[model samples]
Target: MSEVAENIKTTETVAVQPKKPAEPLLSKRRKRLMSDPLDEDNPITVQVLGICSALAVTTQMKPTLVMAIAVIFVIVFANLIISVLRNLIPNRVRIIVQLSVIASLVVLVDQVLKAYFFDVSKLLSVFVGLIITNCIVMGRLEAFAMGNKPYDSILDGLGSGLGYSWIILAVAFFRELFGSGAVFGFPVFESLGLAYENNGLMVNSIGAFLIIGLIIWAQRWRNGYVEHN
Candidate 1:
């Protein structure tokens, strides 16, 4: 009788075990985390951070695209690693910790670029290394990852990475198109049979200034982001 009753208790315990609840991958808040950086709260156009790389690496789509991928990878992974270590790190050393993590990731990216994309590595030169100092990466690590759960931190990083990516890419597209009469080294104007001269101004830094300025104005105007005193 004792054995039978013990087996009944064991059966009930197994039968009554509760399953873990499912969390939505893109809950309303998470979706906002993933998207808000693309435009409205854009790191480049809106917050006006990471402007140096925007002008420097955007002369052509090829190098610009490689740089974008590098940033996205670094930011996303850095956010994940930092968020995981957030609880254990000392507040006094947080900034140091963040920079160390960012610098480590940038080195990894630089090596990968050197290995597989040597030409782009040369084109990007110090700018890839300079990603260590990019405000967006550090700001996100300090702002969102420090306080958020791992998944939310990842989403925020993704949003910010993509936000920076598209803007520079747009600049690159125009610069390369007009500067070389080509897109990604393909002769677009020539292929289209359009009689176009290579715009010397477009290849220069001055052209990047003009392009970025126009983008800032256009984005703000379309979004109705007016500045008020």
Candidate 2:
């Protein structure tokens, strides 16, 4: 009789135990949302958004790195704010509302940069203010943030920011290396005891355009992305 009671108690305990909840961090959809923009669906390389700053600020890596961080902050916060307010926002004024949110964030970034890192902020100049007009930030807010949950919108913004960051970083790396014979202001060629002449063109705007064009071509070819006639 005691053995029968023990068995019943064990069965009841087992039956009452709850199952583990799924890990939101490891969800397939979340992974895809973050990873897709790094390559095939990249905002800059693939979709060709945010190219102005890419060309303007990528003359050196340090300033480019700061700009990238600023952009990431603006995009993620803007997306979160927009997503949370999507339901409350009026349809007719959605564009205006989105612009307002983005502009506010851009001002905050600009002020913070001015307060600290003033030199790099000065280097970035009007480009930092121009984040307000970035199409990537606006596009994601309208297309994804308006419809998605806050968490998903944040991830989309992050993926897009990172996508833009990497491409510009690559451009800066090459430009600084060949253009100034340095990386991040360090005299790389000088340290190596090699006499290197900096390429005048590499430091100029045309160099940025050429590098971006090659990057676009290489990425598209590798991904089998082609214009359909």
Candidate 3:
């Protein structure tokens, strides 16, 4: 009887022993805030979105840098605003609300650019207006921002924007030096005494395209997406 009671007690203790729970999945808001930029999912290099501005504004180092900063500002703020008002936005008209928010931010950025840097603004021209149509901006709003907190969405937007900017600036450096015979608007090859009196390569848009293509190619090669053979 004593042996049977001891056995029963042991079985009860084993049955009552607690099982550890699995770790919880990351929250929607946390996932948005912590995503990386250089992976296969990057908007610029991988997804091939927003290449128009990448080709247009990257002719000169300064303008390319400025455009990149402007994009970062617009994307971060737009995401923050959209996330904040996500619940209030009607499902039927969510897209319209998102557009309204993005458009307002773009206009504000344009106004600031015109007020302080009129010449650069003129050079940018329609490109600045086209920021509203940048796929990354809209994509974030639909994918991550709408379901996340304002702070997390903003960080995600800013990271992607800066990732795009860094690539653009690198492309501009090579384009400006080789194509323009200049760096940051300073003529560096005057002593060469070249036969062509003018720096003709920098002025054309096709030059921008070539520089961007080479950069994308080089990046792909380095990442093992393309082989030297």
Tens-place lDDT digits, model 3, residues 98-129: 88888899999899999999988887888888
What lDDT would candidate 1 get against the real structure? 0.88
Query: Per-residue lDDT for 81-150 in model 1, tens only?
Result: 8877777679999999999999999999999989998999999999999999999999999999887666
Model 1, residue 32: C-alpha shift (Å): 0.9
- For model 3, where is the 10-residue window of minimal lDDT? 9-18
Judged by whole-model lDDT over C-alpha atoms, candidate 3 comes out at 0.75
Error of 3 at 164 (Å): 1.3
lDDT of 2 by residue, 114-148 (tens): 99889988899999999998899999999999987
List candidate 2 stretches off by more than 4 Å.
Answer: 1-23
Please identify model 3 stretches exceeding 4 Å from their true place.
Answer: 1-35, 191-203, 226-229
Better of 1 and 2 by TM-score: 2
Q: Which residue pairs in candidate 1 collide?
A: none
**Best TM-score goes to which candidate?**
2
Task: Quote the positional error of residue 71 for candidate 1 in Å.
Answer: 0.2
Supply the global lDDT for candidate 2: 0.88
- Model 1 residue runs over 4 Å out of place are 1-22
The CA lDDT of each predicted structure is 0.88, 0.88, 0.75
